[model samples]
Structures are given as C-alpha cells and as structure tokens.
Target: MRLIAGVDIGNSTTEVCIGEIDNLGNVTFPASASCPTTGTKGTVVNVHGIKSALKEAMAKIGKDVSDISLIRLNEAAPVIGDTAMETLTETVITDSSMIGHNPSTPAGAGQAVGKLIGFQNLGSARQNEPYILVVPARYSYEDIASVVNRINGMINIEGIILQADEAVLVYNRLDKKIPVIDEVKQIDKVPDGEIAAIEVALEGQGVRMLSNPYGIATLLNLDAEQTRKVTPIAKSLVGKRSAVVIKTPAGNVKENVLPAGEIYLSGEKDISVNLDEGAEKIMKTVADAGKINDITGQSGTNVGNMFERIKTGMSDLGTVEKSDIHITDILAVDTLAPVKISGALAGETCLEKAVGVAAMVKTHHLPMEKIAESLRQDLGTDVVVAGVEAIMAGLGAVTTPGTKLPLAILDMGGGSTDAAIINENGEISMVHQAGAGELVSMLIQTELGLEDRHMAEQIKRYPLAKVESLFHMRLENGQMTFVEDSIDPRFYGRVVLLSENGLIRMEKDIPMEKIVQVRRDAKRKVFVTNAFRALKTVAPDGNLKNVSNVVLVGGSAEDFEIPEMLLEEFANYRIVCGRGNIRGCEGPRNAVATGLVLSYVGEMK
Candidate 1:
C-alpha cells in the first residue's frame, strides 16, 4: 500500500487529507487536518502551513510524516483577490467648517443663530448682537452656566458650544435656556467672530434646520449659490442629534466628486468605464467586455493606485512580473463607506457613496509549481501539483451522499467563488469569479465602521445577540436565552457575537437589529450575487435553470446562513442546493484535498 496526502492551500487556511491506495488502485481516506495559511495562497510561503497541516493530519491516524510516500497539492488557483473602498463623494471644507455629530445628550431643542464668540470674548460682546458662547473644557459646568446666565439678557447669548460633555448640566443651570451642542473635541477650530447656527433636535429625533440646505441658507442669510454650496454640509448633518454650522467670510462646504478614476477592460473589444458613473455602469461595462483578458485603471486615480498595489504585491510574492500580472475579473459593489469629512471641527464622518471592488489577478503560468517544489525539498517526499481546484472539488463533491453525475458545485472560498459542473460523461467545466468571504467581511467592516478585522470576520461567521441582562440575552432571531452564569458586565446592553468561545461584545453603540441587518445584507450582496453570477457562467448553456443539483464546498459553505440563503434563492429555479459532506464525513471542507487524492488514484488506475 502507498500512502499519499493531499494539501489544499486556501486563502485563509491550508487543508490536508491523507489516504492509502491498495495494490488494486483503491483508495481510502485515513485522516484530515487544517491550519491557518501562513501567507498569500499559491505562494512559496505556503510551504510552512502545508507541512504543519501534513504533520497534524498524519498524527490523527497515528502515523509519521515519513510514512506518507507522496504528497499531492491542489493546483491552487492563481487568482488573487484584493478589496478597496473607492469613495465617490467627499466632503471638503474649503474656507469654513462644521461640527455635525450625535452626542449622547445634547441639551435644549430649537435653532440658534449668532456670532461665534469665545467665553472670554463674551465679556466684550456687543449688547445688540446675538453671540454663541464657545466654552473650553477648562471651565466647570457651574462656571460656564454662571457666566452665560450673568450675560444672558445683557449680551444676547443665543446658544452654547461646550468642549466637554456638560451640555445637559450647563443647559439645566442656565436661567435662560438656549440650544446646547457639546462634545466638540476640536473646539479651538471654531473660528472666532464667525456667524454660526446651532440646532438641537428634540429627544429621539434628528436635527431639522441644519440638516436642510434651505434651512441653513435661511438662518445664515445665504444667497442661492451659497445655499447650493452648503448642500453637502446639510447632508452630512441629516441624522445628527445636534450640529453647528459656522459661516466665515470666505468659508464654504463643498461636496466634490472624487477622481475615483476609470477602469479599462481589454477583451474582445477594449472598453473603459469611469468609476464616478457608479457600480452598476461599471459592472455593465465589465459584462459587455465578453471575456476580460486584462483590466487596467486610469493613471493617478484611486482605482489606478489600487490595481498597482495589487500587482506589485503579487509580483513581489511570485515569479510573475508586475506587468504580466493581469486582473482577470472584478466585482464592484455599491456601498456607503463612512469617510471622515476634511476640515470638520469634530472628527465627523459622512456616509459617502462608494464602490467596494474585489479584483482577481491571474498569471500565464501557475504559481503553485514553486510552492510544490519547495514542499518537496522540505518534506523529502514526491510532491505533485494536482488538477485544477474547481475540477477536483467537483470530484470530491460528487462523493456527497445522494449526489450523482451531472452535478454542479460551488466552492466559495475566501478569495474567490468557483463553480464547476461534472456531467455524466465526465466532462468538466468551471468558472472562477472575484469576491467571496473576504469581500463579505470587508463590507461588514466598512458598513459597521469597525476597526477590528477579527471582529468583522467573527461577525460574518457567527450570529449576534444583545445582552439585555446579566442572565438573559436576546438573539438575532428575537429569541431569548437564560444562562446559569452571570454574563460579563462589559457586554451589558451591547450587540455581541455568539462565538464558540462565548459572547464577544462589540465596542460600537450600534443597535442589535442594525448589526444583524448589516451582517445579513453584506452576505447577500457578496455571496448571493456572486452565486448567480458564477452559476450563470458555468451552468449548462450559461443558464442557471439548466443546472440541477449544486453541492456547496469550501470554508464559506459552512457559513451559518449562507447555505440557507442559497437554498432559498435556488428554490425558484428548482435546483437542489445544500452544503456538501465530502466522502460522507467531511462537511463543506477538504473537498479539494480529497479530490486531489482521488484524481491521482484515477491516474494510477
């Protein structure tokens, strides 16, 4: 008997499957294991992870690495996926600035228009002119209230801007109440002697006057052109609880269309589409290109920089030159990315329209040859680069119980979603498309404004809950569960991920329902959309309805909800869809590894 191992290096992990072939060319799986991928997939650095996983798998069956006679490595797809947020719109404060943010408890309700005067300058203010007090954090709430009250009627104090979190305390102490906007981190940025308008919405509501361009114009006595210029500033304050817009002599807030740049597609016909035209047009242009031979971006633009970065990184890792690394496919998704507005008094961010793109770069020569040779040198075993990943995955997918020939498989990995079909006659067809789990995580991170990538990946993988009490928590499905132990106080009243290691609290104050919505929406946008796009490309006659049974295999296929989502979607087309159980033992993983061994045994036969 000859023992062989199959190692599949994926975007996130490396999987290994060990099998023994008898004299009759029969093969039986013995063990399997996985570990985090050491570096980018299909690179020489993957040899470390490949060896680690091989040892782990051998140990599972009480064997040593020397016992394995041969190692089969899946010809890892050369496609490299990279995601970037291309902001189409940017808020630029030219000569003026604004502070529009949601403070926890902004005091008072109503709009106030006055000249922005420092607390010290309040003493020298003109009695006839209305002035807004910009108080520094050095003053106590009592001191600020006392000073504002002392000059309330005498100096016409109309509003208050506090540097500290004392809006409620100061507003309550004032004899004459006025709109109070607090938590101004950059309080010093507020220009002195500029006309300013402050608005505080009623409890549980957003600011009105400041959120409207016409309202800002009416308050600041702006002309038609000036009102048009401040529209972006008004848009930035739409959902704010409290806001302050200041009018300097030459100050203006302008929303500029960023030079996101254009993408050139080379195929049957060279086509170019500008990024400012949005995702739909870009995708349409991509589709019209028939088969994308290569893709390039406009010089000196966001997309240009993005492609250059991707190519440079790939060239650095593999034998391919930067010029030879061509982007084979791209998935452009419309998104609202939270981008910081430039020159804003507060560190405020606006939901700018953006296109989140995932590009796949493919090279003429397979990059896996180097990886296989490196592993052979280290392990001192005959390492052979096996069949294409999708083809091999299909061979293993058919091993699923109740599956037969003419079956289709969707292998949704971190870097790409690959679809393949194995017909009864043993003919195989496959297509690889950009965007998958990584893109989904990117969307979740950007939409939720999360800085922690681990949190985003965990959120994408697990369900969420809200810690209502020490004992009970409400799940995303609105079901409540009580635990015996007291939950951590840190998770109290916060949205948390129900991970295998217990509840992980999210630092952001986003609501449980919104988090759930965003999580599911991101999945739908990437996986579901890519499912249709990929299936159409590989299905018989390029039609999904013509396809029958589809077995999902890969890390993402094990997602808690993605399989069900695909099930619901494919139901309309009468396609049998579910996650694959590789060899009736492995669930939605090790398909490519298992397929590698199976293909080798077939060659032996």
Candidate 2:
C-alpha cells in the first residue's frame, strides 16, 4: 500500500485529503482536514498552513507527515479581486443648513418652525414670540427641562437641539414636551438667529414634512428658485427620523454629479462606458465587447485611482511586473452607499447611489513552483504541481454518488468563481470569473452601513432572527421558536445572527426583514449573476441550455441560501444543480484536494 496526500491552497483556506492506494490501483480516502490559508495563494507562505493541515489529517489516521509517499498540489492560478464604490452624485452644502441623521432615539413627534435662539438667551426672549432653543452640553438635562418649564408661559419654545445625547431624558422630564433633536456634536455651528424648521416623526416612521422640498418652502416661505436649490437637502433627509433645516441668506446646497469616469474595455473591439451612467449600462457595454483582454479607466478620475490601487496591490501580492497584470473580468453592482454630507451638523450621512465594481487581476505566472519546492524540502517528501484547479475540481465532483460522465462544476470561492466541464472523453474546459463571496460581503457591508467586516461576513454566512422575547425568537422566515433557558439580555429585542457559536446580536438598528432582504439580494446580485456568467462561458456553444448537470463546490456552496438560489435559477433551464458531496462524505468541500489524489492514482494505472 502507498500513502498519498493531496493539498489545495485557496485564497481563504487550505484543504488536504489523505488516501491509500493498493498495488491494484484502487484508492480509499483515510482522512481530511482544512484550515485558514496562511498568506496569499500561490506563495511560499502557504506551506505553513499546508503543514498544519497535513499534521492534523495525519493525526486522524495514526500516521505522520513523513509516512506519506507523495504529495500533490493543485496548479492554482493567483486570482486577486478588488472592489471600490463610485458615487454618481455627491451632496455639498455651502453652509450649515441641514442636520439630517437617524439618531437611535429622538424626542417628541411633530413639526415646528421658529427663530433659533441660544438657551442662555431664552430668559430675554419676548413673551409670545416663537423661538427654538439651542442648548450646549455644559447645561444638565434637568436644568434645561427646568428652565423650559419656568419659561413655558413667557416664551414659546417650538423646538430644542441639544449638544448631548439627552433628548429622551429631557423630553420625559418636561411638563410640556417639544421637538427635541440631540447628539449634535457641532451645535455651535448652528446658524444662530436664523429661521429654522425641525421635524420629528413618531415611532416606527420617518420625517415627512422636512423630507419634502415643497414642505420646507412652505415653512421657510422660499420661492421656486430657492426650493430648487434646497431639493438636495430634502433628498438627503429622506428616511431620517429627525431633521433640522435652517434658512440662511448665504446658504446654498449644490448636488454635484461627480466625474466617476469611464471604463475602457480592450477586447475584440474597444469600448468606453461612463460610470456615471450606472452599473447596468456599464455591464451591458462590457458584454458587447467580447472577451475582455484588458480593462482601463479614464485617467484623473475616481475609477482611475481605484484601478491604480488594485493594480499596485495585486502586483505586490503576486510579486509580478505591474505591466503583466491585466484586468480581464469585471463585475458591477448598483448600491446605495452612506456618504457624509459636506457641511452638516451631527455628522449626518446620506445614502448616495453608487456603482460598486469588483475587478479581477490575472498574470502570466505565479511562484507555485517555489511553494512546491519549499514544501518538498521541509516535509522531506515528493511534492508536485498536479493539474489545473477547475479541472481537478470537476474530476472530484464526479465522485459524487449520483453524478454521471459528462459533468459541470462551479467552484464558488472567496476571490473568484471558477467553472469547469468534463466530457465522457475526459476533455475538460474551464473558465474563471471575478466576484464571488468577498464581493457579496462587501455589498452587504456597504449597503447596510456596517463598519465591522466580521459582522458583515456573519450576515452573509448565516440566517438572522429577531429576539421577540426573553424565551422566544422570530426567525427571518417569520417562524417563532421557544427556548427553555433564559436568553442573554444583550440579544433581547435585537436582530441576531443564528451562527454556529450561538445568537450573535447585531448592534445596528436595521430591521430583521431589511437585513434578510439585503443579504438575499446581495447573494443574488453576485453569486446568481456569476453562476450564469461562468456556466455560459464553459457550456457547449456558450449556451447554458446545452449543459445538464452542475455541482457547486467550495466554501460558499455551504452557505444556507446561495445553493438554493442557484438551484432555483438553474431550474428554468432544466439543469440539475446542487451542492457537491465529495466522495459522498465531504459536503461541498475538499473537492480540489481529493481530485489531485484521484488524478495521480489514475496516471499510475
């Protein structure tokens, strides 16, 4: 009997499979293990992760790394994916006129318009004159509430903006409640003695009056031209719980359509599509240009800077010449990114329409041989680069029990999505495309305004639930479950991810339904779209209708909803699509590693 081990080094993980082959050439797998990859794929740094995984798998079989007769590694092509967001338009305010933010808790529920006055000057206000109080953090919430109560009959206080986060506390202590907008970090920037309007929506609602441009015109008595200029301010205030719009003589808001620039596609023919036109048009232009050999962006523009950053990053990671690295594929998705308004109080952010692009970098060579030689010397065992990644994955996919001869496989991984088809004659065709799990996570993070990458990844990888009570939780599907033990208070009344470690509470104020919708939509925009793109490239005659069986293999295939989404999409074409079970044991994983060993044993026979 001869012992052999196969290793697959990927962008995000390293997998190994151990097998024993008899003299008759029959093979049986003994053990398998996987761990996070040490560094960039196709580099010598991967040997650390490879050795760790090998030691783990060997331990499972009561053997050591030295006992393996030979080791096989997939010929991994280094794929680097980089993403950037280009906002089509930006909101610039010349003066501090608008404070539009969705504070977690605001006070009161109404609209009021009056002259702005400092809290220290409230004592000198003329009786029966309407004024809005601007209070600083030096004054306590109790003192503010007490002073407002004392001046109730003498001064008409329409609203109040506090520099501290005491809106709810002050509102509750008041004998007469008024609109309170707190957490204004730059309260001193408020245009004192200017006419201002404040609007606070009730619970579970957004501001209605201030979010409308005509409504602001009615409150501030502005003409058609002034209303047109303030329209961008209103647009930024939409969906906000509380907003304040002040009218100043020199205040102006300009909605600038930024020069996002054009993408130049060098293929069978050259084509240029401007990013300002949006993602759909850009992608359509890309499709019209067949087989992209190189992609470039307009110089001195947002996309140009972004592409330069990507090129530099990839060149450094792969240690290749910058000129040799060509962007061969691009995936663009429409998204609304949170952009901070130019001049606004309270650090306000507005959702701006952006085109998020994921670019794929391909080079002529990578130092995979260096990695193999390093491993050979360290382990004192024979190691060789076996075969292409997609072809090997296709070979391992056929080992699935119910699969047939002519098979197709989609290796949905972190950095890129790869597809391969094997015919009965053993001929293989493969294609690698940009954008996969990482892009999906980027979309989730940008759309939901999440600052933590781990939270966004969790949102992408698992299902979500809303803790309805201490004992019962409502899932994304609207089903409720009861637990015997008391749940953690931190998770109470919050949308939590149902992850392997347990209920992880999401700190954002997003609703469960919206989170679920964003997650599924992101998956559809990336994976489902890439599935069709990859399958068409590898299918006969570039037609998905001609393809029959498709097995999803890789880490992303194990996601709770991605496979189901693809299965539903492929169903229309009568394609049998599902996650692959490698050797009828490993589910949607270790396919490339297993295929490396299988291909070696076949050569021996």
Candidate 3:
C-alpha cells in the first residue's frame, strides 16, 4: 500500500494530513493534525514546529514516518503580498480649474461668442447681447427652470452649455430651441470673456455650421487665424478621457503619439527601472517586453520577479527537471505594498505586490526527490515536503461539494491570512498577508498590557466568563455550571477557568469584563476586516458582488463567532460560508496540505 502525507506550513500553524491511494486511483485520508507553524512563513525560522505536526499526524493514522512512500509540498514563494482597501470617506472641495461634462447632442452650427454668466445672473438688458450659459452639477432640471423662468424676458439665453444631462433637460424646458451640450463635467473651468464654441450633433447628423473651425469663426466674426485657436477646445472634450472642454471658437485640436515598452521579471529579488523613456511612453508599454529586474528600487508590485524567484528555486532543486513542473500554471497572488509607478500618464498606479501562496506539483507520477530539492531551494531551507492523497478516509466523513465557479480558500492562521483562489478553469491565485492572529495577539497584549504572546493568543482565541459565586460559575462558551463546594473568594467575580483546574483567578487582578470586550473588538477589527479585504483583492474585479462563497480554514477559523461574523459581512452577495473538512474532522484548516497532496497525484497522472 502506498501512503502520502500533505503538510501546510502557515504563519501561525502547520497542518498535516496522511492519506493512502489504492490501485484503482482512489485516495483515502486517514488522519490529520495541526500545530503552531514554526518560524516566519517564506523564511526558514523553525523546523521543529513543522516536525512536531508531522509526528502528531502520523501517530493518529497508527503509522510511522517510514510507511509514507512519497510526499508533495506547495511551492513556497518567498514574497508576501499585502493589500489595503480605503473608500472615499470624505469629500473636499478644490479650486475649480477642470470640467468634465457630457452632452450627447447639442443644437446650433458653430461657436457662440459671449460673456459668461450664471443662469440666474441673466437679465432683461442683456437680451440681444451674446452670452454663454453655465450650469452646476448639483442643480436639478427643476432648479434650472426656476432660474431661467425668472430671467426669461431679460436675457437672450442665446446659447446653453450645461452639465452633461442638463443640456437635454434645459432644452426641453425652453420655449425656443438653441444649441445645447448636456454632459459637462467642469462648469467652473469655462473661461470668462473668452470666445468659446459649443459643438452639437443630432442623431444621424454630421457636424453643423459650428462644427467647422472656420464656420464658428465666421459666426463669431473672428479672423481665420483667430478661429483656428478656438478649434482645439471644441475637439478636446469629445473623447474618452475628456469630460469637458471650453476653447476659443477658432482654435484647432491635434493628436500626438507616445512610444513605450514593458518589462517582465521572475524571482523574489528587488529590481530598478531607468526612466529613459518619457512618462507617456512608459504608460503605453505592453507587459513582458524589454528589460526588467527582480527587485525594483521604485516602490510598486512586481509579479515577474515573484515568478522568477519561485522558478529559480524550483529549477535548482530539480523539481522541474525530474518531473513535469509547470510554474505558469500556478497563479501568484501578491498581498504587498502598492507599487508606485512614476512615469505613467495615469498618475501613480498601484501594482499588486504580494506573492504569497503557490501550488507547484500536479500529476501523481512526478519524482519526489526533485520536488524536495526545488522546495528546499525556493523556500530557502532544508525542507521535508509531503502530500496526502485524501483528506477524509478513516474518520466518519461527509463529502460536501462547493459552489461558485471560482472558489477562494482562506487559511486564517495566527501570524498571517493565507488566501488562494481556484477558478473553474483550473487557474489558481494565491497570496499571503503579514498581519493575522499574531497582530490580534499583539493588540490584546498591548491593550491589556500583557507581556506574554501565548497568553494573549489564548485570550484572543477563547471567550471569557466571570465566576459569580462559589456555588456557580460561567464559561466562555456561554454555558453555566454549578460547583458542589465553595470556591476560593479570589476566584469569585473573576474569570473562571474552563479547564480541569476549576475556577482560577487571572494574574495581577485584571478584570474579566474588560479583557473580554477588548479581545472581541480587537479580533473583529484585525481578522474580519483583513479577511474581507484580502478576498476582495483576489476577486476578479476586486468586488465581492461576483463572489458568493468563501471557504475559511485555519486555526483562527475555529473561533465560534468568527465564521458567523464573516457570513454577516458577506451576506449581501448571497455567500455560503463554512470551514474545510480535512480528513472529515479538521475543518477547512488542512486544505493546503490536502491540496499539496492532490497536486502530487495530478503530476503523476
């Protein structure tokens, strides 16, 4: 009988699974175990932690390490991806210089020359005088009507240039029709005392008299050279990026080209790009072309370098050489600082940075020696990588299929939140975030002034209960029990121990109520918020609307309220939330190891 083991090394904990594959290709998971992850993830810190988890899992299956024939490990990409989400929380006003307005159709033939004034400012004495009408975005059609009605007889209201949609509304409201452009983003940028032309075209209608640069100049009684000046403004507002444009009626518009190129790199090394080309040129460059580096001196996300790192490490270890190792098949999800691109026309674009989780082996026939070598080099440590064939075989297990074409597995471990997305097309994306259970523990330790990370972790993991009297006590699980004998007075009204030790008091007289409140709030802020943010970033459009289900696994997911809280936050998207059943017993916590094993089987096939 051939047995395989899967081990997932996470930031807070390491999970192990053991499985057996029969001659018919059916896999059975017999046992699973979880222990705190040793050392920093992606960095070789503690091998003992991982070894202990392996031993515990092996013992559960009633087998020793020698019984295992082969092992599979997930590709340990050294880079960690970090992500942050911030919405427009406040609105601030700035000095108006640019306007973006859209007017689908406008009336009149050419440029209208006149003094600009607000709709309300027009009066009777200006009836024959040429004028430009200005509209504010906030005002409704009704509001514009009231102002126009009051000054109807006093001003000519000769030419109407309003906000994008307002043009149509104002046109319908007028007794006599005039040239109007509706969608205008910037009404504040309209130059005062300038000869501006408004271009309008109806459905199936070409440019009118106002459409020609010279025609507008004729209408405004300007010389040919002067008319050329206004033409530029009229055309500027017509394209995709332009929201609005106000120019001299005679100015002409011209288009210019910018040359560019793109550079792609692979590996964890940092790189720098020299800005030999112009900013616009850089923006136009395509992906995976030209020279690039692993580590970029400029701050930004680098996927190419991440890919290179994983590949180099794997290649050196002979994983790709001895077996069919496919690096491109494994999606690299980065959760890192947003890369700040300096020479792009779009301004500072945030490039996705974190390269956290990766799936290396596929097919069961791949050689293990090469796999181990690759893992050691890439992970930068002496590695013992293993894969289990099945996650539920020995235990009383129920197999539940998952919904959602692209499913995300979130390993909410202690030190970090590891996430991976497996699309229906078999494409996998993964990322590792730095802050996780450890961050929560730090918060609790700092808030309550506790010096111990272990104590803080326990407090963050469990709930609190106060011991009211000697005869009765409360538990963190919300259950109450009675004691036969009188307990110590110090334990009364203090946090009660749920362990076999009975009631015990906390050190230094810390209040149970304060401890509970602080722990709960801290966990919610760190874990829940980070989970949602991570999921959204990995989602197709960075929106949860497309994601309906989130599979949560890890030591942190064991918390009773954590999953429920996630369900509530993602309820709007109709998401079904639950844990992964590794070996039919360990929920959602052993997916990486299980996946690692499954990846091995695919390699053999």
Candidate 4:
C-alpha cells in the first residue's frame, strides 16, 4: 500500500487530496483540505498555502506531510487578471471655471449666454450685460420672483440660479421666460461677474451647449487654445440634463493618457498593434496572425509597462529570466475608469471607457519545477508535476458522484476559465480562456461607476435590494419582504449589496433594479458567453450538442446565481449543466487535487 497526496495550487485557492492505493489498484480518499491561495498562481509564494493544506490533509489520517510517499502538483498556468483600466475623460478648468452636476427639476428650457451676478448686488451690476441671477436660500421664491419682475425692464435677466427648490415656482410667476437652475446645494459658491453659460435642456432632452467644448467656446467667446483647455470639463458633463459652465481663473486641466503601449503579436510573422485601438482589434490581429507564440507590450505604454513590470517582478524572484516568460493567452474587457474633473467641486468625476486586460503567461513550467524540488527537500517525499491543470481538473471531477467519461467540465476560476473533457477511451482535450470572476467584478465596478473595489467585489458576490422602508426591503426581483425590526437608517433610500455579512450601503445614487440588472448582465455576459465558447471548443465536432453533461468547478462556481444562469443557457442546447461535487463532498472545489491522486494510482479512466 502507498499513501499519496495531490496539491493543486490555483489562482485563488490551494487544494489538497490524500488517499491510499492497495496492490489491487483500489483507491480510498481519507481526507482533503483547501486554503486561500497566498500569491500568484504558479509561483514560489504559493508554498505557504501548499504547506498549510498538505499538513491539514495529512493530519486527517493521523499522518504528517513526511509520511506521504509522493506528492503531485498541477501544472498551473500563469494567468494574471489586470484591473488597470484607464478612463479617457477628465475635467479641465480655465479662468472663471464652472463644474456641472445634474440637479433635479430645473425650469424654463433654453440656452442663455450671460454674466453670473449676485442677486443682492444687482443694484450695482452693469446694464446691457446679459445677467444670470444667483439666488440664495434666505430669500423666499415669491419675493425674489416679484423683485426680478419689477426690475425686468432695467436688467436683462436671462437665467436664475437658486439654492432652494423653487425653480418651477419662480418660473411660473415671471413675465419674461428665463431658464432657472434650482436646488443648488452650494449656490453661494457661484462666483459673481464671471462669463457664465447656463443651459437647461427641454424636458426629456439633455443640455448641448454646456456639454460641448466648442459650444462653451462660442458662448464664452474663448479662443482655440482656451477651448482646447476647457474640453475635459465639457466631456465630464456630456450626459447631464442641465449644466452650467463658467470661465474660471487659470487652473489648467491636462488630459493625460496612460500609455498602454502596442501589442507585438507573433503569428505568420510578427506584427505590432496599438493597445489604444482596444481589445477587439488587438485580438483580431492575433487571430489573423495565426498561432501566437508570445505577446509583449510597447515600451512606456500602459500595457507595455504592465508586461515589463510582470517580467521585472518575475526576474526579481531570481528563478526565471525575462525571455523564458511567454504570454500564452490574453483576455480583455471593455470597462470604465473614473477621472476627477479639474476644478470640480464636490469631488465630481467622469466615467471614461477603457479596456481591462487579463493575460495568461506561460513560464516554461519552471515555477512548478522549483516548487517540486523545494517540497522534496523539505518533506523528504518524492514530488512530480502531474500535467496540465485543465486535464487534471477533469480527472478530479470524475470523483464526483455518478460522473462518467464522455463529459466535459468548465473550471470557472478567478483569472481564467478552463474547459476539458475525458472520453470513454481515456483521451483528454482541453482549452483555457481569459475572463471569469474578476472580470465580472471589473464590469460591475465600471458599470456602477464605483470608486471602491471592495464594494464592487461585494456587488459581484451578492444580490441587490433597496432599503425602501425601515421595516421592509424590496428585493431585486421586485418581491417585498418585511423584517421583524426596522432596517438601519443608513441603508434607507439606497441601493444595497446583500452580502453574506449583511446589507452594504452603496454610495452611488442608482436604483436597486438597475444595479441588480447591471450585476447580472455582467455575469451573464462573461460567464454564459464563455461557457458556450468553452463547451463548443472542447465538445466533439466543436459543437455544444456533442457534449451531454458539463460540470462547473472553481471559485466562480460558488456564486449564488452563476450556475443557474449557465444551466438556463445550456438548456437551450439540450445539454445538462451543474456545479461539480468533487469527491461527493467538496462542492465545486479540489477536483484537480483528487484527479492527481487518481492519476498517481494509474486508476484514472
């Protein structure tokens, strides 16, 4: 009899399976253990998690890591999920600058070119100048409107800016129709005597003049240089219903680009493509190039620096050189990044469209080899690199109750999704693609325009609900439920992330239904699309119909709704799909580890 152990060091987890095989080739798994991955997959830092898991699995049978006759580790691919998406929009402010934010319920839709003036100081204000009166909270709507009407002939009052919610009321009483922007929380901050351009869109429309840099230039009579300088602020306010732009004092808005350099794809011949063209173009070039041996980024570009940094980091590890590192596969997603508007008050930001890239680098399997040698020296046990991760994971999935050959498994992990199948004849085929859990999280963060990644992660993991009342909450599916006690006041009137811990308040002002839709849509877009793509590639004849069953395994498999989503999608093709049950106990996890043990005994079918 021999005792063997399998350790699968994954992107986000480290799994271990321990078993004994008798002379007859029968296998019995006595214990298994798993821990969070400590560092990058396929790196030396993973030894911490591997050691911890190995000790735990060995302890289950009253044995230690030293007692194991041999150890097997999966050949984990080097896939890195890069969240460095850059936003293209920024705020630019020149002299007399104004920042625009959406204010609910403005009155009298029309564009007005004017000079902003203080309401009280209008007595000293110059005549023949187009005037936009700024009203404070201390004055009543009735009194202010009456005063403006009385002074109508003497002053050219084209627009009104108010601190209170009285834009409609004041507009109704005015004899001369004028645009009014009300509910300005900081009305006192509007500088007087500045060249102001106020635009209130017609109901159901958006402001045009203030949103366009050229329009602002036309209204403010700014030169070409000034218009170029003000473009960022205009871009920042592009979609608002109403906006106000003022020429402020000499604060410059420099639109800086993070150089995500060119991608060098090696195919029929080597060709370089710009990363700024986005992922679609880059991947298309890669496809056209035929088989891509490796990809690297341009020097000083964002992506270029990213690749260089990865090489520099690995080189710092002193185990691998830069040349041995090869980017085997890459995944990119369209996303948004927030850039603060220059001279923006109240921390205004614009969500700029960007591409989030995740690359899977092949490191000549030296990282795994180093790990094997280290373990052998430390534990006095023989160690070997089993094989590719996807094939091993398929071997592990067989340990699931009632699973058989001629089926496929989708390993939806954090960095990449792996699909593999084991035929009845014992042949195995596999493929790995970029995009999975972290990509979904990136999509959520971009769509929701959130600043905090921790919140974005929670949003990805949980369902959404609106804390409508203190004692009742409206679920994402439009169902309402009552609580025994009143909900927290902080969560009231806010879209919340319903995580395992509790309700997490979202700072962004979005409806719960919208938030829920974006979250689910992002998952469906990444996982469901990848699910079919994976199945079709690995299935017989490259058709999904050829495969009968698919088992999902990985951290993403644990999501509350991803499995259901994939099931519904697969149902259309007459294929059955469900989360894997490794060893009939470990749910959607440790499949590769168990497969290692089976492969060791040569009992794998």
Lowest summed lDDT window (length 10), candidate 3: 86-95
Candidates 2 and 4 compared by lDDT, better number = 2
For 231-345, candidate 2 gives per-residue lDDT tens digits of: 7788888889999998887635545544788889999889999888887788788778988899988887878777787788887875678998899989999888888776666
Off by over 4 Å in 3: 42-47, 77-404, 475-479, 485-490, 497-504
Error of 3 at 70 (Å): 0.9
lDDT of 2: 0.88
Worst 10 residues of 1 by lDDT: 249-258
Q: How far is each candidate from the true structure, as Cα RMSD in Å?
A: 2.3, 2.3, 20.0, 5.4
lDDT of 3 by residue, 548-594 (tens): 66777767787767777777777767877676565455566676677
Query: Which wins on lDDT, candidate 1 or candidate 3?
Result: 1
Q: Return the TM-score for each candidate structure.
A: 0.94, 0.94, 0.48, 0.77
lDDT of 1 by residue, 1-605 (tens): 99999888898999999999998888899899999999877678888998899899999889899899999888777677777677776445544478998889899999999999998776678889988899989999999988877776788989999999999999899999888989898888898998999999988889999999999999999988878877778988998899999887663444554478889999988999998898778888988898999998898887887778777877887557887888889999888888876657767777777888888888665678788888778878998888888888988898899998899999999989998888999898888899999998999999888897788999898898888999999988989999999998988888888888887888888887888888899899888888998888888888888898999999999999999999999999999999999999999999999999999988887
Candidate 3's C-alpha lDDT?
A: 0.52
- Per-model lDDT: 0.87, 0.88, 0.52, 0.80
- How close to the true structure is residue 530 of candidate 4, measured as C-alpha lDDT? 73
- Clash count per candidate: 0, 0, 85, 15
Best by lDDT: 2
Pairs clashing within candidate 2: none
